[model samples]
Target: MFFFFVGGVEQQVRQVLKYGAGRCITCGSKADLVEYEKVLKAFFVPVWRWPGKEQLLHCNDCNLFFPPQLSADRTTTAVADQPDVLRCRFCKEAVEPEFRFCPFCGSSLS
Candidate 1:
């Protein structure tokens, strides 16, 4: 008989230190400064957890966690004010005017 274990360590937000702390480098959305923890799972059950040493910027929209120093300081309002770019109606993500599809959400832009 052969058996396999589906288990791994995952990093997750432990606490939000500050909301709207910065912008995500990838998504340009509001990111929170947060403390994080590493959780070890065995057979999909959490077995142990440990707090991370440094705080990071977490984007809820993109589910990305990045270093605070790497985060951008720009606000979403500034991104929305650009008149040259077209935005998707469903995701509101900016798309090129020539694109017939939203790259972010895969929605038809026509």
Candidate 2:
């Protein structure tokens, strides 16, 4: 008898609690508050899903996950000084100056 099995956990964004305007502690790029769902996949088919709260800071650039409470101070002033930073339409992350693509979300700046 022979059997093949493939399984892994995947995270899916369920809703955006806040746009990616704040800085991420790990990546130093824009982060967002998102409600996510963790899905367990078996053989490329989703078998189980667990919904998460909307208090996580998701960094699109480095794909890092962290709690928002860790960087509460930085988020309050992330975009206050940078007036030239552009917000990504696709991900709504604040893109730094001179970046053609959003470092956080990889969206086109132009």
Best by lDDT: 1
Locate the minimum summed-lDDT window of 10 residues in model 1: 69-78
Give the alpha carbon lDDT tens digit for every residue of 12-109 in model 1: 99999999998776667889999999999999999999999899999999898888876643338887688677777655677778898877657788
lDDT of 2 by residue, 1-110 (tens): 99988999988777778997466765567888888889999999999999975568788887777777754643336556666767665555566667898775455778
Global fold similarity of model 1 (TM-score): 0.64
Model 2 spans > 4 angstroms off: 74-110
Lowest summed lDDT over 10 consecutive residues: which window, candidate 2? 70-79
What TM-scores do the predictions have? Answer: 0.64, 0.57
Kindly provide the TM-score of model 2 when superposed on the true structure, using C-alpha atoms.
0.57
What's the true lDDT of residue 51 in model 2? Answer: 95
